[model samples]
Target: MSKEWFPLIDEDKCIGCLACYNKCEHGVYDVENGRPVVVYREGCIDGCHGCGNLCPEGAIIYSGEYKEHIKCSCGCSD
Candidate 1:
């Protein structure tokens, strides 16, 4: 399966608490320079919000929800 979800850490907002790094059971995060980094993007599980929800500073952002459709600008109908 493709890497559909991963964590995005905001350096400025991160308090270096390591809450996210510890919360992630998939080894998706690591500590470097007192900040959490996405070391293993492929290990992230799709649609899981465990790390983001555990982050105290709200520094972790999870992306990769699949969208079913896109609006066409050319006025085409599927």
Candidate 2:
């Protein structure tokens, strides 16, 4: 399997602070489950520049290729 380039957010760790959205100007982040989720995925493989780093609880992650680094509630990281 090949790796798909994209960044993702951990919704569970997200406190609905919209930090990724507010932090990025690419509109790559959006509100999901009251937290910020990766909406626009394009040329965002390396991650949202600093979206994951801004996360307080380290919910955001850059998983392996072909996998989604963004995670949702229930401790699931795609």
Candidate 3:
């Protein structure tokens, strides 16, 4: 579990596919109203973005000091 690492889901981009929920091995997500929610944020691993990588809509993003470890597809990187 990590204090800084967690998933942020973009509701607009999310299609309620539950891909992130299904990809996560940890109890980090919960299905609510046919969508996924970050229920156990602290359960996220320090350098893991497995769920985000599996999202077809690219709805998931990670917030933490480990941002540099991931390649930003949206060109947000500087």
lDDT for model 2, please.
0.59
After superposition, the stretches of candidate 1 with alpha carbons farther than 4 Å from their true spots are 66-78
**lDDT by residue for model 3 (1-78), tens:** 347878899999999999888877778999999999999987776667688777999999888765444443322232
Model 2 segments more than 4 A misplaced? 1-3, 43-48, 64-78
lDDT for each candidate structure:
0.73, 0.59, 0.79
lDDT of 2 by residue, 1-78 (tens): 343555666656667777667776566677766777777766354323366766677776765554334533222233
**Order of quality (lDDT):** 3, 1, 2
| CA error at residue 40 for candidate 2, angstroms | 1.1
Question: Deviation in angstroms for 73 in model 2?
Answer: 30
Ranking according to TM-score, highest score first: 3, 1, 2
Worst 10 contiguous positions by lDDT, candidate 1: 69-78
Cα error of candidate 3 at position 29, Å? 0.1
RMSD of every prediction: 10.6, 8.9, 6.3
